[model samples]
Target: MDTVKIRNKDMLWDIAADLHFPPGFDSKKKHPAIISVHPIGSCKEQTSGNVYGEALAKAGFVVLVFDASFQGASGGEPRFIEDPAQRVEDIRRVTDYLVTLPYVDEARIGTIGVCGGGTYAINAAMTERRIKAVVSITGVNFGRLSREAFSGYNPLGALEAMAQQRTSEARGGEVRVDNYLPCSVEAGRKAGLTDIDVLEATDYYRSPRGEKPHGATSGLFSHRAAAIGWDAFYLAEVLLTQPLLVVIGDKPGGFGAYRDGQEIYGRAASKQKELVVVEGASHYDLYDKPEPVAEALEKVVPFFTKHL
Candidate 1:
């Protein structure tokens, strides 16, 4: 794996990514490529980005695992901003970078995203025809998830808080940010996040399991405005025309379940689409566990090979 810098087309940010070449690859030959996008608050090294990238590379496809534009090693100000629109643009920009390589097959490019990155990938596919195929693992339609899943998800209250924060910022008040995941295992448990998803997220992002210097699972509080207004399922019936493969855990309840998969599958206008729910796996299990990650890769590798 080699680290490389990709500049967003807007010339606004430099995306840091890990490029994995297929075993015995020939630089003179063009190869199909896959872009593996990490989850929200995740970097190129965390989640299953590297897992999938390495696996696909071994299968003879070039893979690029990257951090989002504003987070991780990517350059951006008002750090940790998780704007969905910009995230979608970031995926396209990465695709832009991929096509520039002489050894990359421009017509056979595909993409995969995990967690919130999954949603961003879907949104990117809506108009980015360069993405011939799309795959989402444990996908979260963050806009919908924020409003529907959590019991205490209050849009009005969040908007009110965002308004207050905006006013305070205008007055030169101190910048305030919030962690996307629990600060610690104890904090997650104390906040009634004993569920598998929360526990695993806390462990993966906060603990040594998958922590990175820039991946603190935190973002600007004002990001609430973008989070609250963004919709991942903006035009599924029309623009989401690419073949889609939604992979998730089978466990009931949570964004990684079959229900969320069905929601995306139902809305997509793709004539060819599939949903694979890994048996007995929970939302976060597919993030890193060997069994679940392997299970997802089993489906993903073939899907892209066939489509792209």
Candidate 2:
């Protein structure tokens, strides 16, 4: 568990990461590596990014769990912004750093993304062939998820608001940010957010389960402007050529919960792609729960071993 700083090729943000090495790791020998990416509005310390990084390290792969630039310990301005282009580039840049290491097998690298990170991972793999395998746990495309979740009800209205907000900001208004989840369980229930996924997300992110002070609860309005119009599913139909594994939950009554993973798995052009729905588990269950996390790693660890 060593903390390291990686500078992006653009020389703008200094990405902060935690590098994990397998027990008795020898720097003299090259080993396969996994780059673990965190979800939107979150950092390296809050979710399954670091957890899977540790698990894969123990499974004998070198792993890096890094905070995306501008989100965590990494350096960037106007904090909590989610720039899709920058995020994808961040993964490629991380891979660039990995290949520079003498102990890393540049030809055998993989990536695991949780939540929105999954979409970024897919996008990165599409253009950067350095990533040999792709694994996503309970993943979702943040752009599509946000748009569809609010469609028909408030999609048009929200778009109008964002446009107005951007215009105001350009004319010199105070910067405004909004939370994607309620600040607490009680707040969520009060706001009529009854879906178990939302409730569990609020509990996990806002509560002691996964909260970190440097990590933010809300995303910037500026960030939303960039994300709202983006679609991660773009170009996935043709350029995504790596072996892909998507692990999503299929709880008894959780119908729309796993649709994003299904869509991603469907669009991928990979000859070897699979969707493993974990029975009785909800989307948020895979974030931190031991049983589901273990089950997820059971599939992912081997996928990398076999492919990378």
Candidate 3:
């Protein structure tokens, strides 16, 4: 296993990535490689990112993992800004870096996007042709997420409202940001309705799950970005030719995302797309748990072995 910081000069943030591969793994032989992305508000230390990255490495894959811009050690001003467009671009940047390494097999590269990273991976797959096989684990439509959170309904109106809020913030004003936390713990509330969505987000983002709890408060008005993020359906409806895998769980919060991924998979031009749902897993459970995580690794190895 090896670790280093990679510099990215695209979009708002410069990336600092960590990569891991098998000891004495043959670089001359075209080997499978994975670019694993972290969940929203998560850094490279997020268990999902490294756990999966390390898992892939142990399985003989050269895995590259990194902190998303504005989140971890990656460089971006006004940190913790959650922009889907930039996040998607980050994956491509990592892919770009990976392709240049002598040890990497450019033709056999794959990607894994977890949580919000899942959406970014989908967007990257749509825009970046270099990605061969793509994995989306409990992904969501980022555009839909902002829309639902900001307004009760009316997607376009919500986007427009975001623009208005951006304008207001520019004018030296403030907007109430929702961090999704109950003022105090209550027993009956559904998990993750507070500052973030995933049930263990607080643990991963704010607790010691990672090396450092994010310095940025999960929510603050200073976090707004460009309106381009409002645009979803990164690519017009079409079949994605790359082999794709979708993993989800039966957790209450997991169903909707799995369904969304399925809908997109149906439109894929790629003949090799598969969906697997772990019956007892939750959205976060897939992030890091012995049983389901191994199952996820199991699903990917053969697929990449065959496709690559």
Evaluated at residue 282, the lDDT of candidate 2 is 86
Can you write out model 2's per-residue Cα lDDT over 206-307, one digit (the tens) per residue?
888888876685777755656667887798999998999999888622224388788889999999998988877887788888888888888988899999
Clashing pairs in 3: 179-195, 180-194, 180-195, 181-194, 181-195, 239-268, 239-269, 240-269, 240-270
lDDT of 3 by residue, 142-251 (tens): 66655565344465665566677778878987655656333223321454354323434445444454435543434433344342345434452573568888888766
* lDDT accuracy of residue 240 in candidate 2: 94
Give the TM-score comparing model 2 with the true structure, all chains together: 0.94
- Indicate the residue-level lDDT of 183 in model 2: 79
TM-scores of the candidates in the order shown: 0.94, 0.94, 0.83
lDDT for 170 (candidate 3) = 84
Evaluate model 3: give its lDDT: 0.68
Clashing pairs in 1: none
Off by over 4 Å in 3: 8-13, 26-30, 154-161, 173-200, 203-212, 215-239
Model 1 C-alpha lDDT per residue in residues 148-243, reported as the tens digit of each score = 543147877877887899789889998888766778889878988756777777777787777878676777876667777778988899999999
Q: Taking the candidates one at a time, how many backbone clashes does each contain?
A: 0, 0, 9
Task: Give the poorly placed runs of model 1, Cα more than 4 Å off.
Answer: 148-151, 253-257
